[model samples]
Target: MIETRILTADDWRTWRELRLAALTEAPDAFGARLADWQGDGDREERWRARLAIPGSHNITAVLDGRPAGMVSGVPGPRGDTAELISLWVGPEARGRGVGDHLIQEVERWALRCGVGVLRLAVAPGNTHAGALYRRHGFAATDEPGDEMASGEREIIMVKYLTAEDRTARDVTAGDLSGGCAPPADSAGCAPRADPVPGG
Candidate 1:
């Protein structure tokens, strides 16, 4: 079974491990280069600062108590929308529904934050990841993402959530992390933070 949990400030160690692994293994998958975070004297302190930012939510997925994957979503310009990012599944755990569970959990968090629209950026050549996003109801939009160091560009995809969809998930605002909490007025509330720290 896949188990998902929000990453609190104390979980920085685990976050760093998985994140570095992702960056090393899939250098082309994210905006930040491995060099950007390779050897930082204040990495831990930086991570703590990241966690304290309100509306920033990072999550990890585990299988049998071992970290398997991660994904995150944070409120967008309007609280009714969010940008999903930092999706990564370890090599050993791919194709085992790890990604699915992560996406589901992020979606749940988004909904509780009053997010009705979810968006993501995926590189065109990354077919597997694109397929996964499509399976979860994402579709391409005209928006363009900045050029990557790898020279590949990003394509935007979006998904819309409806009232009926919110009803399907039994999550309430009270049970959510303060980091993932919706604004005082969730509707059209400005985005205060990102799901991932740097990107």
Candidate 2:
């Protein structure tokens, strides 16, 4: 069974290891590279700060007591928005619903924290991830991401966590996929927040 829970201090090592793996394996998918994070003088402090943000949440998928996948989100500058980040699944864990569960867990955390919108970015070459996000109701935004290491573009996507489009509803993990419309690859979609923090 895969268990999902909030990341704790003790999980820092696992978090760091999985993050390094993601950065190394899927360089284009994430904004930060291993070189940008490695050998930082205050690596521990940075990890603590990341784990300490009030609106930030990390969920890890543990199978047989080992971490297999993880996802995290932090509040955006806007009060009702959050940015999904550091999403990844181990090589052995892919195609087993781990990615979906991680995303669903992030959605639940966003709703529980009163965030009405969730934003993310995907490398244009990462069709699998793009399709997964689309299947879960995320719509592409008009904004484009920064140039990736692989020279391909990235696309921004967002999901609104409200009912009736006027009133804020208590969103749950299951609500993310409820009544979501397919996204068109046109330029008229709504604008989305920057996916990378310093981008």
Candidate 3:
């Protein structure tokens, strides 16, 4: 089973490991690189500060008591807006429902915090992630911004948390539109797809 929990300082080591893994494994998907983090004296401090910030929610997915994935979001410039960031799932956990679970957790957290909008930036070449966001009802927006990595363009996607989404007491990942289909060998979960633009 997959479970989601808020990240804390106690999980600093796990967070660091996963962060470095993301940077190293998918440099073009994120702004920071492992070279940029290597030898940084304040790395731990930076992580601490990030977790300590107000209006920020960092979550990790645990599969069988081990960290399988992570996702994070923080308040945006506008009220009722939150920016999704640093989403990743370990290789061993891919093709499962971990990614969807993480996203649902983020949505649940955002709704509980009274945030109405959730936005995320995807690297133009990341068609897989773009598809996932599009399935979640996140429409591409014209908001231009710096690319997460050099030489790559960023596409902004937004998901509006309507009143129904907030009031629906037991909303699960299936209720949303965009997310990777679960693996065929897994439980008898039906797989579906929606064509996403620019993917």
What is the C-alpha lDDT profile of model 2 across 1-199, one tens digit per residue?
Answer: 7787677555677777788888778877777777876886228766655554554566788877889987877767675677788889988888889999888777766655556788898888788999999988899998977677777667889998765432433444333321121122211112234433322
- Model 3 lDDT at residue 199: 13
Residue 49 lDDT in candidate 1: 64
**Which regions of candidate 1 deviate over 4 angstroms?**
172-178, 182-190, 193-197
TM-score of each: 0.88, 0.78, 0.81
List lDDT for all candidates, in order. 0.76, 0.69, 0.68
* Consecutive 10-residue window with the lowest summed lDDT within model 2: 179-188
The candidate that achieves the highest lDDT relative to the unseen native structure: 1
In candidate 3, which residue ranges exceed 4 Å CA deviation? 169-199
Q: For candidate 1, lDDT tens digit of each residue in 77-102?
A: 66567888889999999999998887
As a TM-score, model 2 comes out at 0.78
Go through the candidates in order and give the clash count of each.
0, 0, 3
Looking at model 1, which ten-residue stretch has the lowest summed lDDT? 181-190
Alpha carbon deviation, residue 163, candidate 2 (Å): 1.7
Per TM-score, what order, best first?
1, 3, 2
